[model samples]
Target chain A: SCYLIPNKMVPGDSNKECTDLKGNKHPLNSRWQTENCDECDCLEKEISCCSLVAIPVGYDKDNCQKIFKQEDCKYIVVEKKDPNKTCDVSQWI
Target chain B: SCYLIPNKMVPGDSNKECTDLKGNKHPLNSRWQTENCDECDCLEKEISCCSLVAIPVGYDKDNCQKIFKQEDCKYIVVEKKDPNKTCDVSQWI
Candidate 1:
């Protein structure tokens, strides 16, 4: 079985604190949340993960960059959480 | 910064070998394949990691299972890899 880890950040004190001039507080700490829980700060970078089986692996933890490609390596299955994307939950089973 | 690892599997020898009558060969090593490289095998367990910022956290590698919930924890936003889903590549920013 396989699943996802939606990495996201949240404000300390539950956003109770005030924000800076840019309307952004000192965002801190990142934890694993519930199912598809995407209600926090965006990832610190732009990242994508394609089905490794379909594409070549591009992983750089130093840069925190991961890219996933299509099976034939012709196209990139940009994993942007789109309805037509290829992130089938059935794969988890 | 954050990124994704498309966990997949591929045939040991690039799927060149044949399979049993059940169409199942002896699945071996699990390596990090291409972008969203979903070819070789699954993650062995059912795991889910939500935006801890928006929801609670649940991580159990022993059971190989993870679950993510909604902000209010009322609904279960199943991470099925759908376009309508909330996975934004920009989050990696």
Candidate 2:
């Protein structure tokens, strides 16, 4: 599974380039880009990224929490169903 | 005014508490919560937070970038208007 690795956990040189899940190389200190299910950015050696999922409304909060929770990552309510206002996690690029 | 202060920049005690925009105090390490237009979390002395705003789907990316850009912050497409597929920043807690 593709996920973000924090700069502190990154070993070796701080300026080392980063490889996305697709094996695409991103230079150091570059803005985040989506790779597979993750959207990530690199700053120095630290990288911050969030997983992308298209969840429907009425999804269990606990389940969503469990599915999306990871070290240094968070699962937020990024979208909601219209009119009904159910939780949604669509839109990733 | 209420924004995250990174742990490294925090002076003196490392376990100092955080104050939200509404003057509510959070412990040293706590999950993020919304205060006004910001959603913030504290880890040690470093705080990570994002400003919140409702934007339409057709909202110009450049304009949105200019409006929400801040030091240590990046504006993302967190939500979109359903049906019409407009940008929305609703649902803050």
Backbone clash count, each prediction separately: 50, 9
TM-score of chain A of 1: 0.16
* Model 2 CA lDDT for position B26: 80
Q: Which runs of model 2 end up more than 4 angstroms from their true locations?
A: A1-3, A6-12, A35-37, A52-54, A57-93, B1-93
lDDT of 1 by residue, B1-93 (tens): 122324333645243232321233333333322122122332232111122222212432343322322233221233344424432221110
In model 2, how large is the Cα lDDT of residue B13?
A: 56
What DockQ score does model 1 reach against the true complex? 0.14
User: What C-alpha lDDT do the candidate models reach, one value each?
Assistant: 0.28, 0.43
- Fnat per model, in the order shown: 0.32, 0.00
Best by DockQ: 1
Q: What DockQ was computed for model 2?
A: 0.02
Which candidate number maximizes TM-score?
A: 2
